[model samples]
Target: MSDLILLRHRQIPDLNQLDVYRQHGGFEAFQKAVTTMNPYAVTDEVKDSGLRGRGGAGFPTGLKWTFIDTENWPHYVVANADESEPGTFKDREIMEGNPFQFLEGVALAAYAIEAAEAYVYLRGEFWQIADQLDRQISELEAAGLLGDKLFDTDYSLRIYTHLGAGAYICGEETALLESMEGKLGQPRLRPPFPPSYGLYGKPTVVNNVETLTNVPLIITRGADWYNSIGTEKSTGPKIFSLSGRVNKPGNYELPLGTTFRELIFEHGGGIPDGRQVKAIMAAGASSSLIIANDEALDTPMDYESVPNVGAQLGSASIIVIDDSVSIDWVLRKTLHFFSHESCGKCTPCREGTFWMKHIIDRVHQGEAAWSDVELLNEVALQIKGKCLCALGEFAIEAVTSGIQRFEPDFRAKVSESSDEDELLVESEKA
Candidate 1:
């Protein structure tokens, strides 16, 4: 798998310095866009590149820019750095290791969109990264690379850094807009999708950290070169954040169609202690559990190929599960996380997640009846296709799949202990 955007900075020791980044062609894209090409041409180049949003939605980057409501004035570009998905930490590495490249990406996007002011909405936990980024922005400003006529052109861009109080809801494009505006960070209604009506009710381009990092390269190398790396419909290299049950669990930037075997066995040093691969939560806990099989192990990791095996290639977060892991216990942990994080904006998600947690916890501790397993599955199904956000909808992916694919594990947990058995007997008598 050939590296594209991710590996360009892999060898750079200190990405925090302005001089080091400039030495590696940091602001070349911004300079090219502002000096040689028109804003429309830059947008066209992105559209031609087939770049899609890396923040799980997979919306085409070019089309998103075209949707900007030109009738609205003073457009904005927001780099969403609030990456709080379970088992997802790819963005952190990008911001921490190659800070300037990411900032350059943000600047180029702002130039393409003609956004005079850009915002890097970071997660509260990432204040250190934000501080470093802020200093970089200031350095760029002093160098006349940013603010009030960038690179000696009329095209000027100023960037601001905003921090969130650690809410998963804020990761949503609309919710991030709300948080930026100092609101409660609840998701707004879509179809007025951010391009037309976004932050400050003006046209806004909100992209993830990794997604924006590719822009400078796309601008420098052209779209055709960008499309050549990955599989059809999902082009370019991806940073696979492999975790759990693996020897080498870290971010690996491989071409999109790289096999699961290579990622886990070759790159990740195989499963821990020679344990057999039982299942995989591709794209973190947000994806449905994929029962590990020969077909699955060889499946190409891409947007198009992953779905054939029953899951979306969301964020490329491959969480490995082994024989030592219990499917029931996995559900217990995920359900508890979702239940606590439920924003309470909608009743189905708020009530449904709490209900699922109580039932799964009881089952995990061997304090529930056999009938409870059936009831819990039903509750999970009810929550599906009926939520305000993907968080609520995907909370039950592991539980629902575990009950169907790994039934024996859940059933075994149904047998109660002496104390639970005595209570069950009393309830039966009553």
Candidate 2:
């Protein structure tokens, strides 16, 4: 296996501490970027390294940095630590276990964007992680690694931690910025994206926690070395947060092109109780349910390849489903989460998710007929293209995919209900 970049703390003790991190060549990249390399040069290296966003969208990271409007004075950078996805937990581990590396990446990004100030917007439940990061930031400042005149250069930076009210919508970039500014956490319309107008109407570069953590390594070893690890298109090691029905459910850091079989079977120790794998939710609750066929199991878990199997490798939060679990039950749980977390800012998402939840509940309880199943599918399709943001669209992925791929599960529920109705009628006639 290739060397671990982001999760190096797993091998080294106390890697979270500034001193231990320094011993292992941490902050050397930050020092190099600030003291020697030009700001754009750092961005260029990241672009060359093919380090796309580890966040769901998988946009190119360095290109995002380049999008910062040079004309806009005093730009801002925000590290999105809001890991609200149902099956995603890799970011939390990175922040809690190997913090200095992540903070260094944030520093490098702030410098590249020429931003004097940055923010780490975390989910409310991560208060302990936030507290840890706060103390680490103070340590970096004290050691002259974060504050003004970093490495005696004109580039100065400061990072602050902001907490959300446990709203999943805040995971979206614009909504995160809004929440950071003390507004309702709802996504803003496009065309004036975050790069042009964000965080008090200034050009901002928002990145995922894992995405930022790769920056320090990319700078220290050069883009060529970083590019050599993963596939041509999807270069770099990815932290796959494997969960659900597996014998060993945890984060596994592997190269991007690794197959699903390798992750679920080899690294994850296969399914528990010797049960056969039924479905794979590659991107948490927001994912389209991938039927666990041989082709899909063999499919590469990368941004470009996962779509071939009808799902995105979103955050690589692979939730394995076994034969013991029905697809309808999964849909019910996912719908409930999306419905409850909907920001209610847009009509489509707010109303659509609410109704979807009710329909799925009925279907799951065997209290609805086949017509209800059709209506559930219809509602999901309607909400697909009409939402203001991706939340409404995400709310329907599993619903539509489950209904289409696992229609047998829904049919069985309806069939069971029909048999019950027939028995009741026969008893009444007697």
Distance from true position, residue 211, model 2, in Å?
0.3
lDDT of 1 by residue, 57-85 (tens): 77888889998888998899999999988
Scanning candidate 1 in windows of ten residues, the lowest lDDT window is: 421-430
CA lDDT, every model vs. true structure: 0.86, 0.92
| Residue-by-residue lDDT tens digits, candidate 2, 1-430 | 5558889888889999899999999899999899898999999999999999998999999999999998987799999999999999999999999999999999999989899999999999999999999999999999999898888778889999999988999999999999999999988888699999999989999999999999999999999999999899999999999999999999999999999999999999999888999999999999999999999999999999999989999899999999999999999999999999999988878888898888777778767767778888898888888866899888899999999999999998774546655543443354
Query: Model 2 segments beyond 4 Å from truth?
Result: 415-430
Clashing pairs in 1: none
Give lDDT for model 2: 0.92
